[model samples]
Target: MNTLAFDTCFGACSVAVTWATPEGPRGAFRFERLERGHAERLMPLIADAMSEAPFDFSALQRLVVTTGPGTFTGQRVGIAAARALSLATGAPVASLPSLAVMAHTAAHQLKGETAGKTLAAAVDARRGEIYVQFFSGPDLAALDEPLLTTPEDAARRLAGRDVVAVGSGSQLLADGARAKGLSISVRLATLEPDVRFVPEAAIPTDFGVPRPLYLRPPDAKPQDGASLARVS
Candidate 1:
């Protein structure tokens, strides 16, 4: 099966095309770091990937995307594009969470060093908040639910545990965690929680319901009459 996968849930945007073969999975093309203009760049990148690989759209077996707890706009753009492409080409679509991608990358790169310990994947959320998730072993079992919280709060929650922290939130969480007497070791990894490191195994067989994993309520919403009257 030939599959196209992408992620735009972090600071960088990435896309990859892979073909399944008897030898193993082979990547035809992989691109990353397009960043905030993912909506604009996504289609072109997909076209470029397909062009380089010379695969027929109708022959594509799956379209995979990173559904997120990252940037709201990026997640929408990526999933929308994936859905559209899937519909147009009549290919099945699958979605995986962004933190799962980070976990996969960390586990793959740090295979021998960690000796099968738990890893905390953290991504920077604006306003001093972070998106955090925990994984155990190479299979990436979830130890804690993903949350959006301040560094101190997160540190407190993860206190008294020996964990390897990876992501943008690692530095802040590590410092706070240590100050709070947590025995966690922070591992600074190059893999951002972005779509760039999405693994082939991360893709699901079924594209479940599309829902944004917002840890906190959105800032923008209809104002109450009291505030409106005060302003008026």
Candidate 2:
């Protein structure tokens, strides 16, 4: 079986193609950090990754994508790409949350370094907010629910705790966490949604409705005088 996994929920866009082998599985990955223009770059990156792997889409048994509470545009692009690829190839599709992916990366990295320490995965939500989640040890037990809140607020909420803060939000919230006396080991650039930590599952044959994990509503709303149409 062959599988393709991708994540664009963060600053970097990544894709991997894996093929089951008698020895286990072999895969190839491509990643690029795009400050902007994720939509323009993702497809070409996917094409390059696929080309390097030399695998045909029709031969793929599964397609996996990271659904997110990251950038709204990035999340939409990733999920839409996965769904479209699955439909075109008749492959099963599976979705994993962006926070979970970050946690996975952290857990994998902290295997022997922090014997009993807890880890926190966070992403910049912009507008003075962060998308955050907590985990314990390598197993990555969930310590709290995923949320979007101000850096100061999150620091206060998780104060007086020793945590290995991982992800971009760590940098964004570093000052607040320090001021709050939180025992935080800032490891911002270390954690990323890479292939090694991605969880695997049997892709569902049914492609149900794909949903975005938006912590809050969009910033823009239609004007009162703007035309609105209901397809249904």
Residue 54 CA displacement from its true place in model 2, Å: 6.1
- Over 75-189, each residue of candidate 2 has an lDDT whose tens digit, in order, gives 8998899888878998877777778778776666766654577677888777888898877755666787788998888888777667777888887667678777665788755
lDDT of each: 0.75, 0.76
Evaluate model 2: give its lDDT. Answer: 0.76
TM-score of predicted model 1? 0.85
- Clashing residue pairs, backbone N/CA/C < 3 A, model 2: none
TM-scores of the models, in the order given: 0.85, 0.86
Q: Which stretches of candidate 2 lie over 4 Å from their true place?
A: 109-111, 156-160, 199-207, 229-232
Winning model by lDDT: 2
Task: Give the least accurate 10-residue stretch of model 2, judged by summed lDDT.
Answer: 200-209
**How do the residues 1-232 of candidate 1 rate in per-residue lDDT, one tens digit apiece?**
7888888788767778878678887775555664579798878888877886647788888888887887878888988888788778888778777888888777767776555676888887878888888877656777777888887788887755667888888887787787777767777645665344555555677765456666667778767664554564
Evaluated against the true structure, the overall lDDT of model 1 is: 0.75
